[model samples]
Target: MDHKAAKRRKLTDKSLPNVILQNPDFAEDSQMYQSLLEMERKLDWTITRKRMEIQDTLSRNPSTTRTLRIFVSHTVSGQSWQAGTESDNLTHSETGENIPAWQLKIEGRLLELPQRGKDKGPPRKFSTFIKRMMVEFDRDTNVYPENNIVEWPRATGHHNPPLDGFTVRRTGDVPTHIRIVMYLDHYPEQYRLNPDLSSVLGIKEESLLGVVQALWNYIKIQGLQDKADRRLVRSDERLRAIFGVETIPFQKLPEYVKRLLSPPDPILLHYSFDPSLPVVEPERPTAWDVEIKMEDAALKNRMGVMLHTNKETSVALAKMDEEIALLAQSLHNSHLKRTFLQSFADDPAKFIQTWLESQSRDLESVLGAGASEGLTLRQEELRRSEFFRLPWVEEAVSVQEGLRLASKGM
Candidate 1:
């Protein structure tokens, strides 16, 4: 019999503590149980490792796993612009079908080769490396209701820099990018990066094309260039076309947003001490102010409805009451997206044209003027349909009154 069985036979009438004291063999049995538990735990660890490997295989990975996309347009005074106002005004362009992103089709064939007992099959065919899907960025740098354009001090300094997005990725037989899940990029500190080991890790590696664009965006709003003498890069491109530690080249845009071609420090995340510290604290307005806000909302709602149904007006005032109600509902929720539809009620042609789905000849007209003068292309997006013109409302109201007069004439 085992140690536990022998000890149990001798402990018939003894209390638990007394049993352990008199029968020292019982203590040995306890140790044996602990040893057995350790072995089981080790077994579990082995099983876990194998399960993870199986799961890794179960998830069919694509050859090209990841892709970086950029949305770029022109902005003159980026930082001075209000974030809340910009969020409201930001819009997407329309295409023939008017979808947010237009998908591209690639001629790729399925690779199903090596039949049961036969030779290998043909390789997958691909016309292009990766498919391009267009995302629109429609800012109201165009004709609209006269809201003052917030301008910052011009880059009157030495350098006028432009930004560029430079992407470094592995080439494949098929032109598709594969995203690494565990992420091997040497630059994980900046979470968006996919560390490529083909080069050095945690060092100056390939510049993330997406990051270059985002960096440009951040720089446009929060530039590092001294506000004065910043135009030197633009004044004489031959002499000084670069800025900062990385020879980020200057272009003809709002920012001297330079692209770091080489690898640098591992982009680590900014670990904050107090996220709760209010950067822009909320102010509690008085009771009278609340009443004014409500009245404004009501008036804006009425105006919006009238504007939305009237294509004759330049503004968007569709179903103003309903639109306001929707806006109110959206406001009731606390979660914030990067942009909101409420602000674009003035004009959205800027966004619509960029994401163009309509097969209209006017698209060229809209786009051509945009490149030069920031014309109809970047008009603020109206949250409502085109029927919201002022003339439409006047006509509708007049038509109803005219019908009543006709009945009186009868």
Candidate 2:
């Protein structure tokens, strides 16, 4: 077949590189360069997918908030509080004798209020917002009380097994007041935006990341991005009134947004517990519902597993990349060899003449005689076909022919 027909057939062939290399046209460096570009595009797509997965995992529940009902109640021995049932006949651990004790029951549960939206399923039995609860007891006496700080670790049944209730017992006089502190895990502090900023953001209180994301959404919806430079934002009238500027840089958006935020209002609860009154009467435990942000443990754990890189996998990938690079280099060298042989195979006479001219130029440049009189004389001799029919050529041919004949006879 003609070279052009063979080249067209090779281009349309649906076969591996090894099979395609059987055709001369497929062995061009241009084909190899195109293959490399395709490989790079695939690699870029893979990396982009991985990055998107990470971003989706991180932003899954950026500001997950829940209402937790904190119940605090006080009761003496032999009396039951509304918090939960407790053993009144508790004996001292060492003495093994019945002792008068004052019990403070501190419990937390997930509250499903009608005002708040309905949950997808039954509310969780416990609060996941609280990592642990710290209860401090202060007495009127000068002596420091033992077990002053009672820690309740399992505040939520989401990840950990649920506990019935957390109780603090004191053998001596009952204190008039107690302090309860809740510690949270993976919870970002919320801020209350000023009136001007809140009007633009549409939310009075939000986490810093949430606020920034909302502002970005607003900018995108309004199409305030500068056409000439995307890094600069063209402030609309509302934004201008809020930021007090005509334009804002994308990077400085967070800084300006932060200035309009103040600390969120603290939750305060006041309850007067009387031990003498019955639990069924007006002396029941006081419960306060407080909304707080918390991380989704299940989603976070899944994301963590996805993001975690195995050392063995990384090593294997690195080895594979090295092998690919070596193979690509080998393929490139093979392509050069194939092109060289194909050129000679297509037209032997012309290939030889072209190759000789290239070699003569290289030799002249290497010998530093390209512009000398000797190079001009050599070029003049090379232009004639009879230059190879000189006396030296005849003598060399005779010597080679004698050597071959003598070897065959021997």
Off by over 4 Å in 1: 1-27, 30-33, 49-122, 126-410
Candidate 1's TM-score reads 0.16
**Candidate 2 lDDT tens digits, 174-265:** 33567677654436867889898898878998888889999999999999999999999999999888889999999998899899998765
lDDT of 2: 0.66
Model 1, 1-410: lDDT tens digits are 32222333234222222333454554465576448446745765665565565445334221222222222111111122222464544543442121122111112222222332322433212211211212111223343223212211223234622113212211111112112111122212122232332121233333343345544444455454445556422222321323323233334322332232433332111111111122254322111100000012223344345324446432342344345445434533421221234222222443344434342335545655544344344344332436446575566456556766777899
Best by lDDT: 2
Relative to the true structure, candidate 1 has a C-alpha RMSD (angstroms) of 46.8
Full-model lDDT for every candidate? 0.31, 0.66
TM-score of each: 0.16, 0.45
Write out the backbone clash pairs for model 2.
none
**Which is the leading candidate under TM-score?**
2
| Number of colliding residue pairs in model 2 | 0
